[model samples]
Target: MRRLALVLLLVASGCRNGGAPSTEVAQPPQTVRNPVPTAYPSEKGDYAVTELVHGLEHPWGLAFLPGGGVLITERPGRLRRIDPDGTVSPPISGLPDIFVDGQAGLLDVALSPDFGRDHWVYLAFAEPTFRGNKAGTAVARGKLEGNALKHVEVVYQQEPKLSHGTHVGARLVFDDEGHLFVTQGDNRVAAAAAQELDKLTGKLVRIWPDGKIPKDNPYVGKSGARGEIWSYGHRNMQGAAIHPRTRALWTSEHGPQGGDEINIPRAGGNYGWPVVTHGIDYSGKPVQGSIGRSTAGMIDPAYVWEKSPAVSGMAFYTGGLFPQWQGDLFLGALAGKSLIRLELEGNQVVHEERLLTAREERIRDVRQGPDGALYVLVDAPDGKLLRISPVGR
Candidate 1:
């Protein structure tokens, strides 16, 4: 049904080659899930933002544990634990050697879905090689033991490492079916590799928890193609989250100068990064060989911000703490300096609002805690972890 909506949107926006009006209106997807309660208190200016922890260095990703604590990944290659009461612990040791270059370091952190029993913590970082001094995204897993990591193992690594540090996308997400999905960037200059199935760059890869490619993956049994690829033709996708009800995988990726986009990536779909973009080069020139928007077989974005927000991390709101925000989507903005909220009616974005605009903080990540509160990670030299809750609570 969401695919139908995309087709209808493309037709309505006259994004087709001939610009002919579409006759078929797509029907909305049936709401099989229970309806979300609509009593929204935060929309009435009844909420308060509290700084929970401080003194962190550019915290990138955040995930809550099954019990109470939170795990945070610092971009400079450190993992820290924050207790439920807001006490920050010493950095966890036994991490892989990471390249601490610009936008290349420890990126995302997530616990195994069965963390309570398995105690596996998965990490993705920019790994440096000694041969060519190049770096690429790598995934590893470790066991939590007090203040250190134990029994660490590398799960996956992008092949043919590149020398650039700007676009090493390393967002991690677990789908509803218990498979791990990792988003990789175009390595800043390898946009052509995005269309190549043999390379893992500029792709969404799905794998089993222990670094094995799923036998049922889209590209399995195909010769010369990586079996782990779920989708391709992505730029630098930094934020990803699975939908609460629809079970769709949504992503926010950085565009060149003005075309940051949000997409519901499809299996084996081409997102047309440098091929067709709403963005231009950093010097305000058009993308090379760009046709402005749609191409022959590439998919169009579900939503796009004409002026780039430098979108970083995103999550779907399903918690009851903010009833009005239920089923909505939240995305962190690095250059826009706010938390952007999207009101969704099915897969289509119906409305948008920017939060924390006045504070002017570059939001790095957004997560809904186990206790139903929203936790936001700020991007700064001295980053902060903030908890946003009701004002009079």
Candidate 2:
């Protein structure tokens, strides 16, 4: 039905679906409409979407503690710790001032894999002003003392901090080798960085734990580009996860018109940004590469949304809670207002289903909390903290 809606709306309105303006339609805005889905459409969940922590100003990143509780970061430059029992810890101190303009601020927070012994948390954020108006993406290490971050030190900083914060794609994953993989969106201010080898914008980078550039990164020897780049040509990467068993790094990124992409970021892979896309230009103008033309060197997306569900977060389901969901992919959608579950066979997506669509809510993030339940944070004022566990046995 989702695919049918896009075709019908496109045939009717020429172009439609997503937040694209009518005048900017690559074709014309389609007027196709479809009924939304529901797990329990008759009524809201009998269980409360419950408030884990209130008073947070636009929280972005969420990480669960080993013993108990979770930590979240507010975009306005504060780190908070919330206990499962609903106790909100005071804001942690020692964060550097950020260039909090539009969409830029303190971002993704995750504890170190060695946290049990290290007592440290890792963070990504917009750095203090640099190059006048632009600011860099910074990764810092801070010690957790009681409820505050102490002995904070930035381990990595992406260059050309002058780009106004548009794409701060900061998701952290620790590879089996203990190296860190970090994703950064192509800060709208810099488009060329996506193709540039040395620059960090619009790229997924790999680094050593202490903030050192990994000696084995693909572009370490490339001149003019930063050394941490694992892949290039990405625009606003938001969803990323290390596959449960394959350990291959897969990422989901936002595209302009209809091309949102799921890519495997191999060393030095070029993902075809402005040069090529499945989507048309936002202005409805022609951009490079027509749809589905078997490009030579460039990698094709594993899955794409013609209607662009505006993907945000994703993870591979390995838990027994949703036995049917095992080995599938769970994705959060913003514009489509849905939770997309992609049925996969190896690297191929066989089928896709929506868990939440009619709600018209923007889902920002999804993760497996410490309690072994799937947790999702909606991106709205009525933003909800939904604990998606298996129906009680």
Give lDDT for model 2: 0.66
Whole-model lDDT values for every prediction: 0.77, 0.66
Index of the highest-lDDT prediction: 1
Off by over 4 Å in 1: 1-44
lDDT of 2 by residue, 188-215 (tens): 7666667787677888889988988888
TM of each candidate vs. truth: 0.87, 0.83
- Residue 71 of model 2, lDDT score: 62
What is the C-alpha lDDT profile of model 1 across 1-393, one tens digit per residue? 000000000001111121222222223111122212212233445655666556667778887776566677777666765543334455566766777678887789888988889988888888777543578888988888877778989899988677367688978998877899998898977677877889888888999999899998889999999999999888899999999888989999999988999999988788997788899998888887577788889999999999999999998888877787889899999999998889999899999988888779999999987766778989987787776665533
Candidate 1 residue-wise lDDT at 366: 97
* Total clashing pairs in model 2: 14
- The all-Cα superposition gives candidate 2 an RMSD in Å to the true structure of 11.5
| Superposition TM-score, candidate 2 onto the true structure | 0.83
